[model samples]
Target: MTEEQLDKLRLDGTKVRVVRDALELNDVVGFVVAWDDENVLIRRPNRRVVKLKRSYAIVPASEPRPDVLTEN
Candidate 1:
């Protein structure tokens, strides 16, 4: 598969996978493990198990700025 395909797979809404980062939730933070077909297995910010699928999207965390600083 092409690199683009792989990236799409990672971001596809129907794709089943884990989010490799901890997230914040209402005063806590933790990582998301996997999606349980119906719900997402999130490692609760408080170190507990919680299922949630409120919102999720695969996108670059940061992008290069278009404007550059140059000195003459």
Candidate 2:
């Protein structure tokens, strides 16, 4: 994704999952922390930071789940 798009996600505090390949094990679920011309930084649920190259990163088309869920 472009820097602008990524920035929107970051600003909105959207949750995203990054998939590098078909393997489920390689998928990462987190929020976009920041991004530059080179890499995108994400913070996982465990508080671990991950950096992924912009060229290799793929953001899914689904809407992100809210940080907190509620039942009507």
Candidate 3:
């Protein structure tokens, strides 16, 4: 994402769901804390901060949860 996009997410203080399919990892639901060109820092509900690559997909948490996610 560009700096503008990241700034928007950061400014809104929105909760987001990040998916890392390439790594076969579980989704992370959290708030955007900070970001740079290559990495985004997110703070999870448990207050743990995680650094993720910008290549991963990040979606707004306000959207309806996908059926597949709930079924799991």
Candidate 4:
């Protein structure tokens, strides 16, 4: 994802589709991340470990992050 796209996700709390590694998908998680050039580091839900790019993943709009950390 691009910086602008990440920013938009942060602003609107929108869901984002990403390609991540399968090894990292051991648990259900939601995170807000700043995308880098080739990958991103997203903070896992409940303050869990942050996963780097692995395979493909999708995060919902209702997911929590530093900006929208509270559930509606």
Candidate 5:
């Protein structure tokens, strides 16, 4: 995401789901705490902060509901 977009997420204090590695499809769910040009710090539900690359895919936590729930 762009810097402006990231800043919005951070400012909004929105819980976000970050895909640090698309290949693994492992999601790190957290709130955007801080960020720089290269990395972002996410405060996880466990109250731990994780630093991830700015290039990673980040989305609002409430979105992207499970497919099982969406499917009939």
Candidate 6:
């Protein structure tokens, strides 16, 4: 994604599915907390934080749930 897209996601508190490696099926579902040119920090439902390279494929998931929308 472009920096603008990432910035939008970060600002909107949108949930994303991050695909680290398609071959290995490594991915995470969470909302981006912060991002720089090199990396992004995501917080999962369990309150666990994951740091991912900016090159990873990060896409929007389903629409935010009502509770999630209210919480943010």
- Candidate 1 deviant stretches above 4 angstroms: 1-28, 54-72
Which sections of candidate 4 miss by over 4 Å?
A: 14-28, 54-72
The residue-level lDDT of candidate 1 at 10 comes to 40
- lDDT values of the candidates? 0.38, 0.73, 0.80, 0.50, 0.80, 0.76
Worst 10-residue lDDT window, candidate 4:
63-72
Which pairs clash in the backbone of model 1?
A: none
In model 6, pairs of residues that clash are: none
Which residue runs does candidate 2 get wrong by more than 4 Å? 60-72
Could you tally the backbone clashes for each prediction? 0, 0, 0, 7, 0, 0
* Candidate 6 residue lDDT tens string, 1-72: 777888899899898888665342466888988888899899998999999898766778673222322333
Instruction: Sort the predicted structures by TM-score, highest score first.
Output: 3, 2, 5, 6, 4, 1
Candidate 6 backbone overlaps, count: 0
- Candidate scoring better on TM-score of 3 and 6: 3
Better of 2 and 4 by lDDT: 2
User: Which 10 successive residues of model 5 have the least lDDT summed?
Assistant: 63-72
Q: Over the stretch 13-71, how does candidate 2's per-residue lDDT look in tens digits?
A: 87888766655567778889988888888899999999988765456427543222131
Worst 10 residues of 6 by lDDT: 63-72
Q: How much is 45 displaced in model 6, in angstroms? A: 0.8
Q: Residues 1-72, candidate 4, lDDT per residue (tens digit)?
A: 456756776677554434333343343454555666655656655565465663334455355322222322
Model 4, global lDDT: 0.50
lDDT of 6 at 58: 75
Residue-wise C-alpha lDDT for candidate 5, range 1-72, written one tens digit per residue:
887888899888889988654333578898998888899999999999999997767889888733432333
lDDT of 3 by residue, 11-66 (tens): 98889888765332477889989988899999999999999998777878888544
